[model samples]
Target: MKSRSLQPQLANLPNYKVRESHKAKHVNLKISPHHGLEVVVPKGFDHRRIPEILQKKQKWIDKIARQFEAQQEFLTPTAADQGVTEIVLQAIAETWRVEYVPTSNPHVVVTEKPGQQLQVRGAITHTDLCHKALCKWLAHKARTHLVPWLRTVSHEVQLPFEQASVRGQKTRWASCSQNKMISLNYKLLFLPPEVVCYVFVHELCHTIHMNHSAAFWQLVGEKDPNYEQLDAELHNIWRYVPVWVEH
Candidate 1:
C-alpha cells in the first residue's frame, strides 16, 4: 500500500489513498466511509498515471463521495442495532425487505413472506441466531440462482463441470477444483449480474486451464469480452454485501 501526497497536477482532484490488491485486474476507484476515496490499483500498475486517471474520473468520484457523506450523516440502524431490515441479491435482481417477529420457538427461522419480504420469527431477540438463519437463507437463494446460472454458462461455453457448491469463503469468490468440481461464494449474490457471470466463466474456464496462463486468459476473453473490467470491479464490490452476511 502507498499513499501519495497531492501533486501539483492533482491539486484539482480529491486526495485519495492507493492500495494494491492481488485480485485487481485493472485500476478501480472506491469510496468508503472510513476512507473517503480510494484508488485500487493492480500490482504493477503505473503510479504516475494515477493523477491523470483521477482527473478523468473526477466527476464520478465527486458524485460517489457526496453520496458517502450523506450516508454517514443519515445512516440508519442495521443488523448490529436491531436486525437486518433488507437483503439485496443483485445477481438475481431481487430485493427482500426483512421483518422480525419474536416467537416462542427456541430457534430462529427465516421464511419467505408475501410481497418480496422475508419473515424472521422465533428467537428474534438473539441477534446471532437471526444472522445465522439469514445466512442459511442466503445460501439457499444462491443455490437456487447461481447453480442454474453456472450451468447455463457452462453449456454456452462448452465447458463442463462435475458439480458445483456454494460456500462462504473469506478470501475467495469462486474456485474450480482439480476434479472439475466448482465452489462459488454465496457473497456473489451481492455483485452485479454481469460480474457474477464473469465469475462463472472464470471458474468454468479453469476446467480447461487450471492455472491463469496466457491460454486461460485467452479462453476467458473468448467467453467474456468485458472480463477485464468485471474482474477489477470484484475488488471493490465487497462493499455491496450486507454486514449481516459477513457476520
Candidate 2:
C-alpha cells in the first residue's frame, strides 16, 4: 500500500518554518527568530521535491518574512543606560526557609532549619545560573503541590487530562495541547493556591476547546465563576517576581 502523505498546499500568505524533527517525523512548521523556512524530511524522503515546495511557498515565505521583521522591531527592548543588578541567589535560597529574613541588600539570609530552604543572593556574579536554580527549585515545589490540586479540580470540573508537568516557561503560565498534555509554569508557585487553581482550570478547559473563543471562556467560567478576577490578580501579583534566566 502507498504510504500516506500530507497534501502540501501553496499557502497564499507566508508561513513559518517547514522542518522535521525526530520528535515530529511528520512535516511540521514553526516560526523561528532568524530562519524563514526550515524544511525537514525523513531520512529516505526525496530531497528533489524541496525546491518545488519552496517555489510553491515563495509568496507565503515572503509575506511571513516581512511580518517577522515587523514583529522583531516591535519586540526589541530599549537599551538600558545602566546595568541592572540581578537578584542574589542566596536571597532566593533563604526565601524557602521558615524564618527567612531579607538583608539590607537584596540577599535572603536563612536561619538554621531542619528542611531545605530557598535562598536568593543577588551578589552572585552569575545571575543567570542563580535564576535557573531558583526556577528549578520553584518548579519542583509546584510539581509537588499543584499535581494533587489539579487532580481535585479536574474531578470537580469533570475534565480529564492525560498527563501534567511543571516547567519554567517565560511567555505563558499554563497551556494544554490538543493531546490533553498540560504544562504549568514554575512561576505559578508565587501565586496563591486559589489563583493557581484558576490558571489550572483555564488550561484544563483548553483540552476541550483548543482556542480562546467565547465558548472556551464560558467553560472556564463554569468551573470557577470568578476565574477572570483570579486571572487578573495572578498577573498583577506575579509582576513583582524577577524573570528567570539561564546561565
Candidate 3:
C-alpha cells in the first residue's frame, strides 16, 4: 500500500504504543471513531522492523487519526435527533402496530390493515421475540416486493441464480454463494421499494461475480445505474433498526 506523511498538526501527538512477541507476522493498524487506535501484529514478526514501518507510514497514520476524529463528530447525535431507539419505536408503531397479530405459532404475519398503523403479533412474550417477529414480517414483505425485480435484473445481467430467500441477518443485507443461492436481509422491508430492489439485485449480481472487483461493480451498474446512491440510502435506513440480540 502507498504511504503518505502525517499532517503537520499531528506531529506532536503521542505515538501509539506497540508490543511485539514471537506470535506476530506483520503489523496491522486500525483507527475508529469509537476506538482511537488499535494495532495488531501476527506471531513471529521482527520487533526491529516495526520502527521502520511506522516511520514510513507516520503521515498516513496521522491522516487516519484525523479521519477518525471527524467520524466521531459526525456520529455524535444531537438531542433533537431521535436516536436509534426512537427510530425503531416509530418504525414499529407506524408500520408494525396495525399489521401485528399474535398467533399460537411462532410466525409473524404482516398484512394491510384498514388504517395506517403497522402491526406486529407473535407467540413469544419477550421484546426479542417481538423483534424477530418484526424481522420475519419485514422479510416476507421484502421478498414479495423484490422478487420480480430481482428476476428482471438477473435476466438483464445474464446471471445464473436459482432462487432468492429472505431472512434476518446480523452482519450483511444480502449474500450470494457459489451455489447461486441468494439470501436477503428481512429488515429491508422497512426501506423504500427501490432500495430493497437494490439489495436483491446486488446479491443476484454476486452469483456471476463472487468478488467486489471492478467487474462486479460494473455488472451491478449495468443492472442498476444508481446502485451507489441506493446503497448509501439503504445503509442509512439500517442504522435506525436496532441490532438483533437473541434472548
Candidate 4:
C-alpha cells in the first residue's frame, strides 16, 4: 500500500508503506532501520483510519525514527567507510581499536593487543567469516561482563533469580520465567549502563508478575522509578546494536 491510501487528515505525516497480516489483531506502526515507516494492520481493518492512529502517535514515531539514524554510527557507516575499525562498549566502559589484515589462510584469527587494540587476521576479505569471528569474541565479552553484572544487580535489587542466560535475541531484550530463570540479550552490551539496569529490573519483576498488568508496572516503578522512561527507550534500542553482529 501507498501513502496516498491514507486519509487526508494525515497529509502532513511522512509517507508510510502498509502491510496486512491475518495474524495481526491491532494496528502496529514502527520504523525499521532497513525499511522506513512501516504500518502493519489486521487484514480487515479500515485502512483509512491508520492515518488517524499514526497521527495520534506521531510524536513517538518521530522520536524513534530519529534515534535510528543517530544510533551507533559504526553500525552503518558512510560510503567512504570500509569496515568496523573500533568498538566502544559503554556497558563495560571499554573501547577497543581494531585492525584487520587479510591472509592466504582459510581460518580467521583474532588477538587482543595492548593499549586497547584488537587484531583480526586470516580471511579478512570474507565479510561473513570476519563477522563470525567478531561475534564469537563479543559473546565472550558478554559472558565476562554481562553475566556477572546481572548477578551483581540482582543482588543489589534483592531479586535473586534461579539462573541467567545471555543470547543474541533479535526482538527481546530480556525475559523472566515463572521458574525464576532469566534470559538476557547479549546485544545489551550496546546500551547505556542505566538502560541495561532497567531491562534487568523489568525482567526480575516478571518473577513476581508474568502478565504486564498495572500491578506489574507498579512493581517495576518501585524498583526503577524511571521505568516509564526506560520502557520508552527500549522501543528503539536496536539502534545500539551493530549491523555486523546480525542480532
Error of 2 at 108 (Å): 17
The backbone clash count of each candidate, in order, is 0, 24, 23, 0
**Model 4 per-residue lDDT at 246:** 63
Superior by lDDT: candidate 3 or candidate 4: 4
Structural similarity to truth (TM-score) of each candidate: 0.70, 0.52, 0.52, 0.75
**Which candidate comes out best when scored by TM-score?**
4
Residue 93's lDDT within candidate 4 is 86
Worst 10 residues of 4 by lDDT: 72-81
lDDT of 1 at 62: 68
Runs in model 3 with CA error above 4 Å? 1-96, 99-113, 116-125, 232-235, 240-247
Cα lDDT of model 3 by residue, 129-178, tens digit: 55555555566665775566677767866776887787666546678877
Give RMSD to native, each candidate.
5.7, 10.6, 9.1, 4.7
Model 4, 1-247: lDDT tens digits are: 6554445765645578887765456787756564467787878888868777887987787776676657636445452135678778878888898899888989887789899898999988877777778777877788888888888888888988999887776546787777989887877888899999999888888888876768888989999999898888777666666677662
> Which ranges in model 2 have alpha carbons more than 4 Å from their true place?
1-95, 98-116, 119-125, 243-247
Stretches off by above 4 angstroms in model 1 are 1-79
Query: What is candidate 1's local distance difference test score?
Result: 0.82
lDDT tens per residue, model 1, 39-76: 88888888998888888887876666666556553343
Residue pairs that clash (backbone atoms under 3 angstroms), model 4: none
Model 2: lDDT of residue 242:
43
